[model samples]
Target: MALAATVAGAPVHAQDSDWLSYRDAYRGMVAFEKYGKPKQFLQQHYQVGARDGSPLPVDFRLALSGKTMQLNLPLDAVGRAVFPLLKAAYDENAVLTVNRKLGAYVFRPRISIVVRPDGVYEGAELRAACEQALDFQRTVNAAGYRDKHCVGVRFTFAKKPDADVRWKGGAPLPAVPGPAFPDEAGNAYSVVTVRFDAATDKGQVVSQNAPLAVSPVFE
Candidate 1:
């Protein structure tokens, strides 16, 4: 909430820039923090991904630094970090940096469903969460989202073949190689996308291995 604000029309060019302005990133994210809507089941993360759709380096990490504060933000396998909303950092106009000299990387805010510790998720609950995300998206920037609809959720797992995501007491959901988050680069992981429909809405999804993240799919 302490981020100085920007919105849809803000520039996101990354052609020659090596680092991202934390003030700009915060402005984009503060909308979610200020949104008074149903978002209990969703979470936001600061994401850094390759601009050219290339796979991220194995040691990829984000750095949040300011005049008085220097913090290392470790990225998950998919390049997401739990962004710190610090008033001091905002006051000093911190910057988010990747490995020095690292280019072709872009930064954005990501929203996804909260992963449950038990690896069990109710289908209806998933639908509700997706709706909540979609609704909130419209409040800030409704451009492409104005006519879109939530169709399903995509669960991205580790970069391996044996992800083991399936419907409760049913066959495994077919998974394809894809990125863990939207607009991300590289098909580095197995992704199982479950559609919201009568056959699945009343059931449950059981993930044998914990997913890196589950994102709502809008179409």
Candidate 2:
């Protein structure tokens, strides 16, 4: 008799736990506490363009339970190196899935912003201008994002726009802030808001999220 090697179901190459933790693939500066491992992976594979220091906060889910990613890189040998680190990040018995198109996993719906310029548009007028754009009919399809129509609203201005603008915007835009806008002084930059679990497919004003202002004082 000859012994044969075989898998029980469809030659399963990998296994993942029944429950996978949800993750957001943010484009902007995200806190390393909840997404520590994923950030580490991005830092290690710096070429992936995941951490380009862009103001546009993109969001998506990680292949693993918000910790690691698995890939069967037959053609891309370099990708294989990232596996061990990703695998170890999760639990010993925690099942993981192999995501081939890891890049696609990151979805940037659209970086819609109120171009509140740096010059005269610094304060109230900036907010007024942003209001026009926000009030416009630019729809954002948040299918790729876990939260439907949850937007990472960015208010571009040399100075803070009316805080009231943070609570404004439509269903598709979800003009919600990422975090609380800091009162710290520096060169002008955009304010990003973190909006979670918005229940609309279009930009609906989510007034709850606070804004986080990012000032770039490049030396």
Candidate 3:
């Protein structure tokens, strides 16, 4: 599988059962959900295009503060890495717009993480990696998302290897790379499987998803 090419530490074949669960769990979490009300400061629509104006699929990473959420849409691979950082920064400056009449804040925190080239691979490790990345992005951004005084709170993504990597409590194939393709939306994406480790944060890292939008895409 494509994930094997990305995992650098272990041999491809190691565990089995564990990898299977990982694959099943990962696939179960791909649907999109509405988060909350939108903000006026964020862009209404993000334009995701390649350097040459080619339409690229956009994957998003999100971070949330008390009532504010930050959305990031990376236009390229390099931008993908920096997208989380940008969300962190934006969440820092977001102010709560309160509504006296409603006795509540006018803005509701919400974010959506999407990727182009959907279903590039089918396995446990890739799903775990995506979840981990999302969790980290959300937690780190939370520092800025919430009030400046917010403290003593910690966030982390769960660490679990893909099913192909573990079976019957034994490690299976290290990780395999999978086919590359674009989703019906016409965007390219790739999936890689990797073992999950709380230490060094290595094992499985896949190609970044398309740009993600944290806007109130819903009403």
Could you tell me every candidate's TM-score relative to the true structure? 0.89, 0.20, 0.18
Summarize candidate 1's per-residue lDDT along 1-219 as a digit string, tens digits: 222235632225454566677778787878788889889999988776776666678877678989999999988767778888888988898888777444566567788899999999999999999999889878877785799899999998875566777889989889888887655657777889888887767899998888988999988
Model 3, position 218, has a per-residue lDDT of 10
Cα lDDT, all candidates: 0.79, 0.25, 0.24
Whichever of 1 and 2 has more TM-score, that candidate is: 1
Residue 52 lDDT in candidate 1: 61
- Report the C-alpha lDDT of model 2 over 6-45, residue by residue, as the tens digit: 1110011112223322111121112222232211111211
* TM match of model 2 to true structure: 0.20
Regions of candidate 1 where Cα sits further than 4 Å from its true position: 1-11, 100-102
For candidate 3, the 10 contiguous residues with the lowest summed lDDT are 150-159
The reply for model 3, stretches above 4 Å from the true place, is 1-74, 77-187, 197-219
Best by TM-score, which number? 1
Pick by lDDT: which candidate is best? 1
